[model samples]
Target: MQWITIFKKEILEDWRNYKWIWVPLVFIVICIMDPISTYYLPQILESVGGMPEGTVLEPPEVVPSQAIMMSLTELSMLGVLVIVAISMSVIAGERKSGVAELILVKPVSYFTYISAKWAEKLLLVFTSYLIGMLASWYYVDLLFGQITAGQFFSLFFFYLIWLIFVISLTIFYNTIVKVPGLVLTLTVVTIMAMSAINQIFSYRMPWFPNSISGHITKMLMENSVPNALWGAVSITIILSVGLLIASNFILKTKEMAD
Candidate 1:
Protein backbone atom coordinates (compact mmCIF):
# COMPACT_ATOMS: atom_id res chain seq x y z
CA MET A 1 0.00 0.00 0.00
CA GLN A 2 2.74 2.44 0.90
CA TRP A 3 4.68 1.45 -2.17
CA ILE A 4 1.58 1.94 -4.24
CA THR A 5 1.23 5.48 -2.94
CA ILE A 6 4.78 6.25 -3.91
CA PHE A 7 4.27 4.69 -7.30
CA LYS A 8 1.08 6.63 -7.89
CA LYS A 9 2.69 9.90 -6.91
CA GLU A 10 5.63 9.27 -9.19
CA ILE A 11 3.35 8.29 -12.04
CA LEU A 12 1.36 11.46 -11.62
CA GLU A 13 4.55 13.46 -11.65
CA ASP A 14 5.73 11.60 -14.70
CA TRP A 15 2.58 12.54 -16.54
CA ARG A 16 2.76 16.15 -15.46
CA ASN A 17 6.37 16.41 -16.49
CA TYR A 18 5.73 14.57 -19.74
CA LYS A 19 8.62 12.30 -18.90
CA TRP A 20 7.08 9.70 -21.20
CA ILE A 21 7.00 11.40 -24.55
CA TRP A 22 9.74 9.35 -26.20
CA VAL A 23 8.27 6.07 -25.00
CA PRO A 24 5.11 6.11 -27.12
CA LEU A 25 6.93 7.66 -30.06
CA VAL A 26 9.42 4.81 -29.98
CA PHE A 27 6.68 2.23 -29.67
CA ILE A 28 4.73 3.72 -32.54
CA VAL A 29 7.85 3.75 -34.64
CA ILE A 30 8.50 0.10 -33.91
CA CYS A 31 4.91 -0.86 -34.70
CA ILE A 32 4.77 1.04 -37.98
CA MET A 33 8.31 0.46 -39.14
CA ASP A 34 8.14 -3.31 -38.78
CA PRO A 35 5.19 -3.86 -41.12
CA ILE A 36 6.55 -1.37 -43.60
CA SER A 37 9.82 -3.22 -43.67
CA THR A 38 8.13 -6.60 -43.82
CA TYR A 39 6.00 -5.47 -46.73
CA TYR A 40 8.74 -3.78 -48.70
CA LEU A 41 12.10 -5.13 -47.62
CA PRO A 42 12.29 -7.89 -50.22
CA GLN A 43 11.33 -5.54 -53.01
CA ILE A 44 13.83 -3.00 -51.78
CA LEU A 45 16.54 -5.62 -51.65
CA GLU A 46 15.72 -7.13 -55.04
CA SER A 47 15.62 -3.74 -56.72
CA VAL A 48 19.36 -3.71 -56.42
CA GLY A 49 20.46 -5.85 -59.35
CA GLY A 50 23.54 -7.80 -58.24
CA MET A 51 23.58 -10.98 -60.28
CA PRO A 52 23.39 -12.28 -63.91
CA GLU A 53 21.22 -10.35 -66.33
CA GLY A 54 18.68 -13.21 -66.53
CA THR A 55 18.58 -13.77 -62.74
CA VAL A 56 15.30 -13.10 -60.92
CA LEU A 57 14.63 -12.52 -57.24
CA GLU A 58 11.79 -14.28 -55.57
CA PRO A 59 9.61 -12.23 -53.20
CA PRO A 60 9.89 -13.34 -49.63
CA GLU A 61 6.77 -15.02 -48.27
CA VAL A 62 5.22 -12.91 -45.55
CA VAL A 63 3.75 -14.75 -42.58
CA PRO A 64 1.60 -12.35 -40.61
CA SER A 65 2.53 -13.71 -37.20
CA GLN A 66 6.19 -14.09 -37.99
CA ALA A 67 6.44 -10.69 -39.64
CA ILE A 68 4.75 -8.89 -36.76
CA MET A 69 6.84 -10.73 -34.20
CA MET A 70 9.98 -9.98 -36.09
CA SER A 71 9.14 -6.32 -36.23
CA LEU A 72 8.39 -6.16 -32.50
CA THR A 73 11.60 -7.93 -31.62
CA GLU A 74 13.65 -6.12 -34.23
CA LEU A 75 12.67 -2.73 -32.85
CA SER A 76 13.52 -3.97 -29.40
CA MET A 77 16.65 -1.85 -29.46
CA LEU A 78 14.46 1.25 -29.33
CA GLY A 79 12.52 -0.27 -26.47
CA VAL A 80 15.78 -0.85 -24.63
CA LEU A 81 16.85 2.77 -25.09
CA VAL A 82 13.55 4.03 -23.78
CA ILE A 83 13.71 1.75 -20.79
CA VAL A 84 17.20 2.97 -19.94
CA ALA A 85 16.22 6.61 -20.30
CA ILE A 86 13.15 6.23 -18.11
CA SER A 87 15.02 4.39 -15.41
CA MET A 88 18.03 6.70 -15.55
CA SER A 89 15.86 9.25 -13.81
CA VAL A 90 14.65 6.74 -11.25
CA ILE A 91 17.23 7.44 -8.56
CA ALA A 92 19.89 9.61 -10.12
CA GLY A 93 17.51 12.37 -11.12
CA GLU A 94 15.93 12.48 -7.69
CA ARG A 95 19.30 12.87 -6.09
CA LYS A 96 20.22 15.59 -8.52
CA SER A 97 17.03 17.54 -7.84
CA GLY A 98 17.05 17.02 -4.08
CA VAL A 99 13.78 15.14 -4.39
CA ALA A 100 15.33 12.23 -2.60
CA GLU A 101 15.60 14.25 0.59
CA LEU A 102 11.99 15.31 0.41
CA ILE A 103 10.89 11.71 -0.12
CA LEU A 104 13.10 10.40 2.61
CA VAL A 105 11.64 12.95 5.00
CA LYS A 106 8.36 11.19 4.43
CA PRO A 107 7.37 7.91 6.07
CA VAL A 108 8.75 5.90 3.15
CA SER A 109 11.51 3.37 3.55
CA TYR A 110 14.28 3.18 0.99
CA PHE A 111 12.91 -0.16 -0.07
CA THR A 112 9.46 1.30 -0.66
CA TYR A 113 10.87 4.21 -2.61
CA ILE A 114 13.04 2.05 -4.85
CA SER A 115 10.33 -0.55 -5.22
CA ALA A 116 7.82 2.09 -6.25
CA LYS A 117 10.18 3.46 -8.87
CA TRP A 118 10.82 0.01 -10.28
CA ALA A 119 7.13 -0.82 -10.33
CA GLU A 120 6.22 2.41 -12.04
CA LYS A 121 8.97 2.05 -14.63
CA LEU A 122 8.05 -1.57 -15.26
CA LEU A 123 4.39 -0.67 -15.68
CA LEU A 124 5.25 2.12 -18.09
CA VAL A 125 7.53 -0.11 -20.18
CA PHE A 126 5.04 -2.98 -20.25
CA THR A 127 2.21 -0.66 -21.19
CA SER A 128 4.24 0.81 -24.01
CA TYR A 129 5.27 -2.63 -25.25
CA LEU A 130 1.67 -3.87 -25.16
CA ILE A 131 0.47 -0.90 -27.12
CA GLY A 132 3.18 -1.44 -29.71
CA MET A 133 2.42 -5.14 -29.93
CA LEU A 134 -1.31 -4.60 -30.40
CA ALA A 135 -0.76 -1.93 -33.03
CA SER A 136 1.71 -4.17 -34.84
CA TRP A 137 -0.78 -7.02 -34.67
CA TYR A 138 -3.55 -4.95 -36.21
CA TYR A 139 -1.37 -3.56 -38.97
CA VAL A 140 0.09 -6.94 -39.84
CA ASP A 141 -3.29 -8.64 -39.78
CA LEU A 142 -4.83 -5.93 -41.91
CA LEU A 143 -2.10 -6.23 -44.48
CA PHE A 144 -1.60 -9.97 -44.34
CA GLY A 145 -4.20 -12.01 -42.42
CA GLN A 146 -5.33 -13.23 -39.03
CA ILE A 147 -2.81 -14.48 -36.49
CA THR A 148 -3.36 -17.52 -34.27
CA ALA A 149 -3.99 -17.10 -30.54
CA GLY A 150 -1.07 -19.31 -29.60
CA GLN A 151 1.23 -17.43 -31.93
CA PHE A 152 0.10 -14.08 -30.59
CA PHE A 153 0.49 -15.07 -26.96
CA SER A 154 3.78 -16.79 -27.55
CA LEU A 155 5.26 -13.77 -29.26
CA PHE A 156 3.87 -11.47 -26.59
CA PHE A 157 5.43 -13.63 -23.90
CA PHE A 158 8.79 -13.42 -25.57
CA TYR A 159 8.45 -9.63 -25.88
CA LEU A 160 7.50 -9.31 -22.24
CA ILE A 161 10.56 -11.29 -21.15
CA TRP A 162 12.85 -9.21 -23.31
CA LEU A 163 11.36 -5.97 -22.01
CA ILE A 164 11.75 -7.13 -18.42
CA PHE A 165 15.37 -7.95 -19.01
CA VAL A 166 15.98 -4.53 -20.50
CA ILE A 167 14.27 -2.79 -17.62
CA SER A 168 16.24 -4.84 -15.11
CA LEU A 169 19.48 -3.89 -16.77
CA THR A 170 18.54 -0.22 -16.68
CA ILE A 171 17.57 -0.37 -13.04
CA PHE A 172 20.78 -2.12 -12.19
CA TYR A 173 22.74 0.58 -13.94
CA ASN A 174 20.75 3.35 -12.24
CA THR A 175 21.40 1.88 -8.84
CA ILE A 176 25.10 1.46 -9.32
CA VAL A 177 25.89 4.78 -10.96
CA LYS A 178 25.19 8.37 -9.85
CA VAL A 179 25.28 10.21 -13.15
CA PRO A 180 22.44 9.65 -15.61
CA GLY A 181 24.54 10.01 -18.75
CA LEU A 182 27.20 7.74 -17.40
CA VAL A 183 24.58 5.26 -16.30
CA LEU A 184 22.88 5.21 -19.68
CA THR A 185 26.12 4.96 -21.60
CA LEU A 186 27.53 2.27 -19.37
CA THR A 187 24.32 0.29 -19.45
CA VAL A 188 24.12 0.32 -23.25
CA VAL A 189 27.76 -0.62 -23.59
CA THR A 190 27.48 -3.38 -21.01
CA ILE A 191 24.40 -4.95 -22.60
CA MET A 192 25.99 -4.89 -26.06
CA ALA A 193 29.27 -6.28 -24.78
CA MET A 194 27.53 -8.99 -22.78
CA SER A 195 25.43 -9.93 -25.79
CA ALA A 196 28.52 -10.25 -27.98
CA ILE A 197 30.32 -12.21 -25.32
CA ASN A 198 27.40 -14.57 -24.94
CA GLN A 199 27.18 -15.14 -28.69
CA ILE A 200 30.84 -15.95 -29.04
CA PHE A 201 30.82 -18.32 -26.08
CA SER A 202 27.27 -19.68 -26.27
CA TYR A 203 28.44 -23.16 -27.16
CA ARG A 204 30.55 -23.38 -24.04
CA MET A 205 28.32 -21.24 -21.78
CA PRO A 206 24.83 -22.22 -22.79
CA TRP A 207 23.35 -20.80 -19.59
CA PHE A 208 24.35 -17.22 -20.40
CA PRO A 209 21.24 -15.06 -19.95
CA ASN A 210 22.33 -12.20 -22.15
CA SER A 211 21.65 -14.14 -25.33
CA ILE A 212 18.82 -16.18 -23.89
CA SER A 213 16.08 -13.81 -25.05
CA GLY A 214 17.25 -13.95 -28.66
CA HIS A 215 17.38 -17.74 -28.50
CA ILE A 216 13.89 -17.73 -27.05
CA THR A 217 12.63 -15.46 -29.80
CA LYS A 218 14.12 -17.75 -32.43
CA MET A 219 12.48 -20.75 -30.81
CA LEU A 220 9.18 -18.92 -30.55
CA MET A 221 9.39 -18.13 -34.24
CA GLU A 222 9.87 -21.83 -34.94
CA ASN A 223 7.00 -22.55 -32.50
CA SER A 224 9.22 -24.65 -30.27
CA VAL A 225 10.02 -24.26 -26.58
CA PRO A 226 13.70 -23.60 -26.07
CA ASN A 227 15.35 -24.91 -22.94
CA ALA A 228 17.01 -21.50 -22.49
CA LEU A 229 13.68 -19.80 -21.80
CA TRP A 230 13.69 -21.01 -18.21
CA GLY A 231 17.26 -19.84 -17.78
CA ALA A 232 16.36 -16.42 -19.12
CA VAL A 233 13.40 -16.15 -16.80
CA SER A 234 15.51 -17.14 -13.81
CA ILE A 235 18.29 -14.69 -14.67
CA THR A 236 15.79 -11.88 -15.15
CA ILE A 237 14.26 -12.54 -11.75
CA ILE A 238 17.64 -12.73 -10.09
CA LEU A 239 18.89 -9.54 -11.72
CA SER A 240 15.73 -7.60 -10.88
CA VAL A 241 15.83 -8.65 -7.24
CA GLY A 242 19.54 -8.06 -6.97
CA LEU A 243 19.26 -4.55 -8.41
CA LEU A 244 16.37 -3.68 -6.13
CA ILE A 245 18.44 -4.75 -3.16
CA ALA A 246 21.47 -2.81 -4.34
CA SER A 247 19.41 0.33 -4.93
CA ASN A 248 17.95 0.17 -1.45
CA PHE A 249 21.37 -0.32 0.03
CA ILE A 250 22.80 2.66 -1.81
CA LEU A 251 19.89 4.86 -0.81
CA LYS A 252 20.36 3.89 2.81
CA THR A 253 24.09 4.52 2.90
CA LYS A 254 24.43 7.67 0.80
CA GLU A 255 23.19 11.10 1.69
CA MET A 256 21.67 13.45 -0.83
CA ALA A 257 24.90 14.40 -2.61
CA ASP A 258 23.54 17.56 -4.05
Candidate 2:
Protein backbone atom coordinates (compact mmCIF):
# COMPACT_ATOMS: atom_id res chain seq x y z
CA MET A 1 0.00 0.00 0.00
CA GLN A 2 2.78 2.42 0.85
CA TRP A 3 4.65 1.46 -2.33
CA ILE A 4 1.50 2.26 -4.30
CA THR A 5 1.27 5.57 -2.49
CA ILE A 6 4.85 6.37 -3.37
CA PHE A 7 4.31 5.21 -6.93
CA LYS A 8 1.32 7.49 -7.34
CA LYS A 9 3.28 10.39 -5.88
CA GLU A 10 6.14 9.85 -8.33
CA ILE A 11 3.66 9.77 -11.20
CA LEU A 12 2.27 13.11 -10.07
CA GLU A 13 5.73 14.59 -9.70
CA ASP A 14 6.70 13.48 -13.22
CA TRP A 15 3.42 14.80 -14.62
CA ARG A 16 3.95 18.19 -12.97
CA ASN A 17 7.46 18.30 -14.38
CA TYR A 18 6.07 17.47 -17.87
CA LYS A 19 8.37 14.46 -18.06
CA TRP A 20 5.57 12.16 -19.12
CA ILE A 21 4.83 14.28 -22.19
CA TRP A 22 8.20 15.65 -23.14
CA VAL A 23 10.30 12.53 -22.58
CA PRO A 24 8.22 10.46 -24.99
CA LEU A 25 8.03 13.35 -27.42
CA VAL A 26 11.80 13.72 -27.36
CA PHE A 27 12.28 10.01 -28.06
CA ILE A 28 9.68 9.91 -30.82
CA VAL A 29 11.12 12.98 -32.47
CA ILE A 30 14.66 11.66 -32.31
CA CYS A 31 13.71 8.28 -33.74
CA ILE A 32 11.44 9.61 -36.49
CA MET A 33 14.09 12.04 -37.65
CA ASP A 34 16.54 9.19 -38.25
CA PRO A 35 14.35 7.47 -40.82
CA ILE A 36 13.26 10.65 -42.54
CA SER A 37 16.78 11.99 -42.76
CA THR A 38 18.14 8.73 -44.09
CA TYR A 39 15.40 8.52 -46.66
CA TYR A 40 15.95 12.06 -47.98
CA LEU A 41 19.70 12.33 -47.47
CA PRO A 42 20.63 12.27 -51.15
CA GLN A 43 18.04 14.84 -52.17
CA ILE A 44 18.88 17.09 -49.25
CA LEU A 45 22.60 16.87 -50.03
CA GLU A 46 22.12 17.62 -53.73
CA SER A 47 19.79 20.53 -53.03
CA VAL A 48 22.42 22.13 -50.85
CA GLY A 49 24.86 22.02 -53.81
CA GLY A 50 27.99 21.97 -51.74
CA MET A 51 29.79 19.38 -53.85
CA PRO A 52 32.62 20.13 -56.33
CA GLU A 53 31.66 21.15 -59.86
CA GLY A 54 32.17 17.65 -61.35
CA THR A 55 30.97 15.58 -58.40
CA VAL A 56 28.14 13.18 -59.20
CA LEU A 57 25.84 12.53 -56.26
CA GLU A 58 24.24 9.12 -56.24
CA PRO A 59 21.37 8.05 -54.00
CA PRO A 60 22.16 5.48 -51.39
CA GLU A 61 20.40 2.14 -51.41
CA VAL A 62 19.34 1.64 -47.84
CA VAL A 63 17.19 -1.32 -46.95
CA PRO A 64 14.35 -1.06 -44.43
CA SER A 65 16.17 -3.19 -41.88
CA GLN A 66 19.33 -1.08 -42.15
CA ALA A 67 17.28 2.09 -41.79
CA ILE A 68 15.62 0.77 -38.65
CA MET A 69 18.97 -0.33 -37.27
CA MET A 70 20.43 3.11 -37.95
CA SER A 71 17.53 4.67 -36.08
CA LEU A 72 18.24 2.40 -33.11
CA THR A 73 21.94 3.24 -33.27
CA GLU A 74 21.04 6.90 -32.87
CA LEU A 75 18.52 5.98 -30.19
CA SER A 76 21.13 4.04 -28.25
CA MET A 77 23.41 7.08 -28.12
CA LEU A 78 21.09 10.11 -27.85
CA GLY A 79 18.26 8.22 -26.21
CA VAL A 80 20.55 6.82 -23.55
CA LEU A 81 21.77 10.34 -22.81
CA VAL A 82 18.19 11.52 -22.46
CA ILE A 83 17.41 8.62 -20.14
CA VAL A 84 20.43 9.32 -17.96
CA ALA A 85 19.73 13.05 -17.81
CA ILE A 86 16.11 12.56 -16.80
CA SER A 87 16.82 9.87 -14.20
CA MET A 88 19.99 11.48 -12.82
CA SER A 89 18.08 13.11 -9.98
CA VAL A 90 15.61 10.41 -9.03
CA ILE A 91 17.02 9.79 -5.59
CA ALA A 92 19.74 12.44 -5.46
CA GLY A 93 17.25 15.27 -5.93
CA GLU A 94 14.99 13.94 -3.20
CA ARG A 95 17.92 13.55 -0.85
CA LYS A 96 19.24 17.03 -1.69
CA SER A 97 15.84 18.66 -1.12
CA GLY A 98 15.25 16.79 2.18
CA VAL A 99 12.15 15.10 0.77
CA ALA A 100 13.73 11.67 1.12
CA GLU A 101 14.48 12.21 4.77
CA LEU A 102 10.96 13.42 5.43
CA ILE A 103 9.47 10.47 3.61
CA LEU A 104 11.63 7.96 5.46
CA VAL A 105 10.60 9.47 8.77
CA LYS A 106 7.13 8.22 8.01
CA PRO A 107 5.87 4.58 7.98
CA VAL A 108 7.88 3.45 4.97
CA SER A 109 10.78 1.04 4.48
CA TYR A 110 13.75 2.09 2.37
CA PHE A 111 13.25 -0.92 0.12
CA THR A 112 9.70 0.15 -0.56
CA TYR A 113 10.84 3.67 -1.28
CA ILE A 114 13.58 2.61 -3.68
CA SER A 115 11.46 -0.03 -5.36
CA ALA A 116 8.69 2.43 -6.11
CA LYS A 117 11.04 4.93 -7.67
CA TRP A 118 12.79 2.20 -9.66
CA ALA A 119 9.52 0.83 -10.97
CA GLU A 120 8.31 4.26 -12.06
CA LYS A 121 11.54 5.02 -13.91
CA LEU A 122 11.71 1.60 -15.57
CA LEU A 123 8.16 2.00 -16.84
CA LEU A 124 8.79 5.47 -18.18
CA VAL A 125 11.96 4.53 -20.03
CA PHE A 126 10.49 1.34 -21.45
CA THR A 127 7.32 3.02 -22.69
CA SER A 128 9.12 5.99 -24.16
CA TYR A 129 11.57 3.70 -25.98
CA LEU A 130 8.87 1.38 -27.28
CA ILE A 131 6.82 4.22 -28.69
CA GLY A 132 9.86 5.82 -30.25
CA MET A 133 11.05 2.59 -31.85
CA LEU A 134 7.61 1.81 -33.19
CA ALA A 135 7.35 5.25 -34.74
CA SER A 136 10.74 4.76 -36.36
CA TRP A 137 9.69 1.35 -37.61
CA TYR A 138 6.64 2.86 -39.25
CA TYR A 139 8.62 5.48 -41.09
CA VAL A 140 11.30 3.02 -42.12
CA ASP A 141 8.63 0.77 -43.50
CA LEU A 142 6.97 3.56 -45.40
CA LEU A 143 10.16 4.96 -46.86
CA PHE A 144 12.38 1.96 -47.53
CA GLY A 145 10.49 -1.32 -47.33
CA GLN A 146 8.68 -3.52 -44.86
CA ILE A 147 10.59 -4.73 -41.82
CA THR A 148 9.33 -8.06 -40.58
CA ALA A 149 7.69 -8.26 -37.20
CA GLY A 150 10.44 -10.61 -36.07
CA GLN A 151 13.24 -8.20 -36.93
CA PHE A 152 11.53 -5.25 -35.27
CA PHE A 153 10.62 -7.17 -32.11
CA SER A 154 14.06 -8.76 -31.82
CA LEU A 155 15.74 -5.37 -31.92
CA PHE A 156 13.24 -4.01 -29.41
CA PHE A 157 13.70 -6.88 -26.96
CA PHE A 158 17.47 -6.76 -26.55
CA TYR A 159 17.67 -2.98 -26.72
CA LEU A 160 15.05 -2.80 -24.01
CA ILE A 161 17.24 -4.97 -21.78
CA TRP A 162 20.18 -2.64 -22.39
CA LEU A 163 18.07 0.38 -21.44
CA ILE A 164 16.85 -1.29 -18.24
CA PHE A 165 20.43 -2.05 -17.29
CA VAL A 166 21.34 1.63 -17.69
CA ILE A 167 18.38 2.72 -15.56
CA SER A 168 19.44 0.44 -12.76
CA LEU A 169 22.98 1.80 -12.89
CA THR A 170 21.75 5.39 -12.76
CA ILE A 171 19.45 4.76 -9.78
CA PHE A 172 22.22 2.96 -7.94
CA TYR A 173 24.50 5.98 -8.32
CA ASN A 174 21.68 8.34 -7.36
CA THR A 175 21.35 6.63 -4.01
CA ILE A 176 25.01 6.95 -3.04
CA VAL A 177 25.88 10.32 -4.58
CA LYS A 178 23.96 13.29 -3.27
CA VAL A 179 25.27 15.56 -6.01
CA PRO A 180 23.40 15.00 -9.27
CA GLY A 181 26.23 16.26 -11.45
CA LEU A 182 28.65 13.84 -9.87
CA VAL A 183 26.11 11.09 -10.14
CA LEU A 184 25.74 11.80 -13.85
CA THR A 185 29.47 11.85 -14.32
CA LEU A 186 29.98 8.59 -12.47
CA THR A 187 27.23 6.77 -14.35
CA VAL A 188 28.42 7.97 -17.74
CA VAL A 189 32.01 7.17 -16.99
CA THR A 190 31.16 3.70 -15.71
CA ILE A 191 29.13 2.96 -18.83
CA MET A 192 31.86 4.18 -21.12
CA ALA A 193 34.42 2.14 -19.26
CA MET A 194 32.32 -0.98 -19.54
CA SER A 195 31.80 -0.39 -23.27
CA ALA A 196 35.51 0.13 -23.82
CA ILE A 197 36.37 -2.98 -21.88
CA ASN A 198 33.86 -4.97 -23.87
CA GLN A 199 35.23 -3.62 -27.10
CA ILE A 200 38.79 -4.49 -26.16
CA PHE A 201 38.08 -7.99 -24.86
CA SER A 202 34.85 -9.01 -26.54
CA TYR A 203 35.97 -12.58 -27.19
CA ARG A 204 36.96 -13.13 -23.60
CA MET A 205 34.08 -11.16 -22.14
CA PRO A 206 31.11 -12.05 -24.27
CA TRP A 207 29.07 -12.44 -21.12
CA PHE A 208 29.70 -8.87 -20.04
CA PRO A 209 26.70 -6.55 -19.78
CA ASN A 210 27.99 -4.20 -22.46
CA SER A 211 28.23 -7.09 -24.88
CA ILE A 212 24.47 -7.00 -25.18
CA SER A 213 24.80 -4.11 -27.60
CA GLY A 214 27.09 -6.14 -29.82
CA HIS A 215 24.68 -9.05 -29.71
CA ILE A 216 21.85 -6.71 -30.62
CA THR A 217 23.75 -5.58 -33.68
CA LYS A 218 24.66 -9.14 -34.61
CA MET A 219 21.05 -10.19 -34.32
CA LEU A 220 19.92 -7.33 -36.53
CA MET A 221 22.46 -7.88 -39.27
CA GLU A 222 22.50 -11.66 -39.29
CA ASN A 223 18.84 -12.14 -38.37
CA SER A 224 19.89 -14.51 -35.61
CA VAL A 225 20.81 -14.40 -31.97
CA PRO A 226 24.45 -14.83 -31.15
CA ASN A 227 25.61 -17.78 -29.08
CA ALA A 228 26.53 -15.28 -26.41
CA LEU A 229 23.13 -13.61 -26.45
CA TRP A 230 21.81 -15.62 -23.52
CA GLY A 231 25.03 -15.23 -21.59
CA ALA A 232 25.13 -11.47 -22.07
CA VAL A 233 21.45 -11.18 -21.16
CA SER A 234 21.81 -13.32 -18.06
CA ILE A 235 24.77 -11.35 -16.81
CA THR A 236 23.04 -8.04 -17.53
CA ILE A 237 19.92 -9.07 -15.62
CA ILE A 238 22.02 -10.27 -12.70
CA LEU A 239 24.01 -7.06 -12.64
CA SER A 240 20.91 -4.93 -12.81
CA VAL A 241 19.39 -6.80 -9.90
CA GLY A 242 22.65 -6.59 -8.04
CA LEU A 243 22.81 -2.82 -8.53
CA LEU A 244 19.28 -2.33 -7.22
CA ILE A 245 19.97 -4.53 -4.24
CA ALA A 246 23.14 -2.60 -3.58
CA SER A 247 21.23 0.67 -3.89
CA ASN A 248 18.69 -0.50 -1.34
CA PHE A 249 21.50 -1.71 0.91
CA ILE A 250 23.34 1.60 0.72
CA LEU A 251 20.17 3.50 1.51
CA LYS A 252 19.55 1.21 4.48
CA THR A 253 23.07 1.81 5.74
CA LYS A 254 22.68 5.57 5.39
CA GLU A 255 19.43 5.38 7.29
CA MET A 256 21.11 3.38 10.07
CA ALA A 257 23.88 5.94 10.37
CA ASP A 258 21.33 8.74 10.70
TM-score for each of the candidates = 0.85, 0.94
Among residues 3 or more apart in sequence or in different chains, the pairs in candidate 1 whose N, CA or C atoms overlap within 3 Å are: none
What clash count does candidate 1 reach?
Answer: 0
What is every candidate's alpha-carbon RMSD to the true fold?
3.1, 1.7
Q: Candidate 2: give the clashing pairs.
A: none
Judged by whole-model lDDT over C-alpha atoms, candidate 1 comes out at: 0.73
TM-score for candidate 2, residues paired by index: 0.94
Model 2 alpha-carbon miss at residue 212, Å: 1.7
Candidate No. with top TM-score: 2
The 10 consecutive residues of candidate 2 with the worst lDDT sum are 249-258
lDDT of 2 by residue, 117-208 (tens): 98898888888888899999899888999988998898788878888899999999988987788888999999889889988998898989
Please identify model 2 stretches exceeding 4 Å from their true place: 255-258
